[model samples]
Target: MRLIAAGLLLFGTLAPTLAIPPPTKPPCCPRHEVFTECGSSCPATCNSILERNANRVCPDICVRGCVCREGFVRNRDGKCIPPDRCGRDGHRPGDSSEEESGIRCHRPNEVFSECGSACPETCDSIVKGGSERKICTKNCVIGCTCREGYVRNADGECVLPEECPRHESSEESTKCAPNEVFSECGTACPDTCANLDDPKPRPCTRNCVIGCICQEGFVRNDEGQCVLPSQCPNSDAIASSSLLLAPLPECGPNELYNECGSACPETCDTFNGLVENRACILLCVPGCFCKDGFVRSKDGQCIPPSECPKPTGSTPTIEIITPECAINEVYSQCGSACPATCETISGRSPPRVCPAVCISGCVCRAGYVRNAAGKCVPPYECESNPECGPQEVYRECGSACPPTCRNVLNPNLEIACIDKCVAGCFCRDGLVRHHNGKCVSPKQCRIPIGIFTVGSSEELNAE
Candidate 1:
């Protein structure tokens, strides 16, 4: 009881002191928001911007430690250096011991032998002529400096010399129409339409920089004359509208509208259900193409569909048959109604394969597969390997034969099964024979284009 009373007395004595919590650790310095903490330094050259923002908390240790400011990087001595000096060693820019100089400055990439003048506070002191503005220097030091991709203009501004207005030395007049200019070197032509979607990375034709070039709103015509955008016959209605004139017929992102006088015939008018061709747009002039299974011949003609070689690997060969039904009508067997397109499948019962020898519902669109539900689904949604038994391993699920005959996982099979279904596994590596049938290597399995029966003797013998 006496000890309990003594403990109570001690607690009462220290309660007031304990109640006073230690000072809350201040929040990190606000300037630290922009600066990264590199590490400790012996002679710190940075100043604390923490006082400027009341909400900032100082770091527990190294409260005044060195930090790299925005656009500046930290050096070995924990000094904040300009971006140029980030990887450089032992190169302090403004460490001169010269006398104080009066204010005068050079823009970026400009330098003198010494600190001949203090850095200018503003750009107004240097800007001189047409469309040019002054840009103040980031550093005050002067030395033998190399400015890349830029030259000091007469206006005392460091600017890119390329594409700048060039002075013509020849007395001959090379005047162009409004919105056009004469250049010593010009490019052939630019595809104005291609640049509509993305302005960056616009194509460059030598006609502009090499010789006389039309300005942004103008294009050169057949007579080699710079004319209004409307005069450029190649500019289609949609392109013209995009350029802000009249609206015209619109094509898919891949398709291009060709005018009457354009080069290639427009065959894409008929909907074939495929992406437009890239080569067709280039060679055929006014055509919307880069058709599938077709390549542009050296003579600038699209190779006929029948002449194209088969695509290698497991890519399915689509059998396209003209149906007896009206144009755009889905094809089906002679008696049964053609399976509906996937677009209509949800509204009807599961569809069956159109008759093989005869017309069938329109061939499923590319990248689609018939699922176990008898519904059309994207290939990616098809069930994975399903036929493999307990001993077999499941690899990829698809509508073709796996490489191995006796699936490492499904040993019960008498013949290799290559059905489009939930997939089954092939024999494990180095296994010579399967428990039930011939041992086939994964590489030996070949899924040809078009249709084939699953577990057929022909397919097994071919293997």
Candidate 2:
């Protein structure tokens, strides 16, 4: 009678839908690929499936109706006992948890995403020279490759693909002239080379054909061959021979780096955080910069120093040991007054310094505005207002502002507001802030947009 009851329990657990007799060994049941499919008969005490046992070595049999779930075995007294509760002395030699079996690789970026011997095979395939890391994606596909921004070189060291110089014997070498060298596969190499300080030196092209370019201090001659810098008429070598230096043209008002220094002069390092990669110390073709936030006026006049934008928490605080300015160039300061240069050129009111700490810089040209790309483009060229991010639009000096962000200073105010101007990007009228710090439309927004007061139009026009 006891034997019959135990057999009935096993049968019910395996096939509650069917009333067939319990088999001697578990059958190859349909696999539960998802956790939701693995249902529990008694969810309160025992789990329906052992997550560890959900792999290939274990059969995809059900333990739903009466028997205990996987990671558990029936005791002599007919009670389900966890693997830990089972005495080690009573346990058989082969009986062990999946984790104890030592088949899984617990390395970072590597996971056992699926049930199969295939994962083990993939792990084994990782020979010394092969992929250093292997990851199982969410879809259970094994992604074996080098880390981000790194490619395996011929020596098998995970180095930058660009830093690995191409030799004449390489496949890319045949595409270039005998005098030219293969720079990269589908990249834009510099047309003229100088020892300019490049923060990011990489290929700019996106073709698979590979690029052939001249080396540094060299230029492509009319014969399509690389020649020495001096040989090229337009090379404009700053240093003549060993000692003499070429005189730089005097820069007009509000310019920086119009002349050459002994080495690359450090400029734009401070503005990197406020404006992404806007300034750089260059060795070749140095000129005056309008700073990151400032743009030259259309009439070739500079904006007053006081009218520049302010730096924010996002702005990096880098200290340059020697802050050098070019001839007629103004040293950048926190609150330097702007020159009335634009007023004389455009006959408009002198622009005030952009509000915020360390926001001062050169003014933009008339009829043109600086876009996110940092290019001085016509006002109409700005298709949409500057996007602080997705779902955020620029709020002009007089435009309606969002309520949540009220009384808060915006980091990216377009036009300086002394009395009447409103500035910076804001969430759209119908949009609101989401929990993730992103502005979202009505559907995804947790804080729904509602009635809110904005700055009065009359007050805005009063300025």
Candidate 3:
């Protein structure tokens, strides 16, 4: 429903003749006041997707201007937003600390990712020093060498991995950078919260949440509050938390909690349970859990068993997350070892053996050339390294394994074929070398690296 104001003012500040029209069949009623002026009629002048997009976002229309709708958000152009987020926080959405702050955020967040994505909106400084923050990415596969103030952890979280235990020997003072957050942890700031007025700094201090502290001299009063102007030497200290000093951006126009000053929910599950991570959950209330053998989660509420059962079928598909992939690790069950391989990251579970097993609906891992049996097999040999090298002997001829392989990919495995099997070329052509067996065009067979012998000089006759 395009808006038609109730108890509102403004005889006609807006001129619909120039205003953007609402969508076709916009939901009747329940539409807010901001969109009221947007007119219920469709605008024949614009594209239909624009009409639909505008209506889809009409929920974010602020009665005032083009702000976001209550509980919803808008972008710079005043478009509707995603749950508890802006476009991109520029931080790994998976990082733990980034999430906790999301909890303390304003909206349910589970429904608003397009608004509150990044933080601080500004930083004291973003310095680039020695590579102490090892960024584990495709660009730096071997092992990232991070810069100062950042350390690479096992799971590859570039954090303050190790802190030189406070030297009891010397009670010297540690200086904080100009505006850099410095605590016992490290110098890197918090979610760089888009909300900056939060005078007391809270970074990934304790565990992962934002740990707030009173300014230098002031201590927390009993009310769990810190009276700034009266308590601190400087008046500008507590001026933050105030709307005037730190106005929550009018960015999200109609959003209910846009500037409400509270964190949002992290993740949700319709069934098993909203994770303990951000206290972000909402299921079947106190009455809902899963109905027995069936399971329900935020994503799937009450999934019946046998809908797609069988874990060993040629194209097996399970009801939910499979058993293998239950353990915390990465790249466990693709046919051959490679950087990327899974159809889905089943969170934590036992590895799914390929060729004979799959999570039912999940796609086959990469590097595996599906066999006639439909089981996933390595692109090369399907046997252990011992068959190709030494300790690789005990290696099983199956997919999925514990994360303990010292070196991945057997170097002695069958080589990449340019055209067809080389032996086939030799046997059919009287043992003469035929780059490839497939009697095809010469351009198809690429030259092999490091394999051309000195005496084998024979070029196809040309003009």
Per-residue C-alpha lDDT of model 2 across residues 1-463, encoded as one tens digit per residue: 3443544455553422212121122233323222221233122111213333334233222221244455565433334566565443464432432232223543333333323322233212322223233453322222233444554455444455455554445565457665566653433345443332233433232233346776554566555567665555544553323212445556666655543321222233322333344323223334565543444443544454344445556755556453553333344433223332322122122224332223234434545554555554555555434435544566555322232222223221122112333455555444444333444333322222221112233321232
Q: In candidate 3, what are the lDDT values of residues 1-463, reduced to their tens digit? A: 0122311123244332221111122223323213332221111111222223343211111121222355543333224445445435443322332232122223211122212211111111122122223322121111123333544343333344333223232223333232333243332232222223354423221132223444442333333343433333333554433523443333221122222122222222322233223331111111223333553323543455444233332533324444452222223322222122221121112234322121123234555533334455554432212211111112222212111111112211111112221110011111111232212112212223122221211222111
What value of lDDT does candidate 2 attain over all alpha carbons?
Answer: 0.38
TM-score versus the correct structure, for each prediction: 0.18, 0.21, 0.17
RMSD in order of candidates: 31.3, 24.8, 33.7
Q: Lowest summed lDDT over 10 consecutive residues: which window, candidate 3? A: 421-430
Cα lDDT of all candidates, in order?
0.38, 0.38, 0.27
User: 2 or 3, which is superior by lDDT?
Assistant: 2
- Candidate of highest TM-score: 2
Provide the global lDDT of candidate 1 against the true structure.
0.38
Once model 3 is optimally superposed onto the true structure by TM-score, how far is the C-alpha of residue 324 displaced, in angstroms? Answer: 21
Per-prediction tally of clashes: 33, 24, 71
Which residue runs of candidate 3 sit more than 4 Å off their true CA positions? 1-171, 185-362, 365-377, 381-463
Candidate 1 per-residue lDDT over residues 1-463, each given as its tens digit: 3443544455553322111112122234433234221222211221112112223322212112234455654444444556454435653444431211111334566544332222332232233223333343332232323244554454556666652445544545565666676665455344343333333332232132444577766655555455665556656653554566645566544334453222334332212323244222121133344445444443445555444444446554556566554333345333233533332222112224443223235444445545556655665565443454322345553223332333434331222222344333443333222322333332322222111222322333342
Distance from true position, residue 131, model 3, in Å? 25
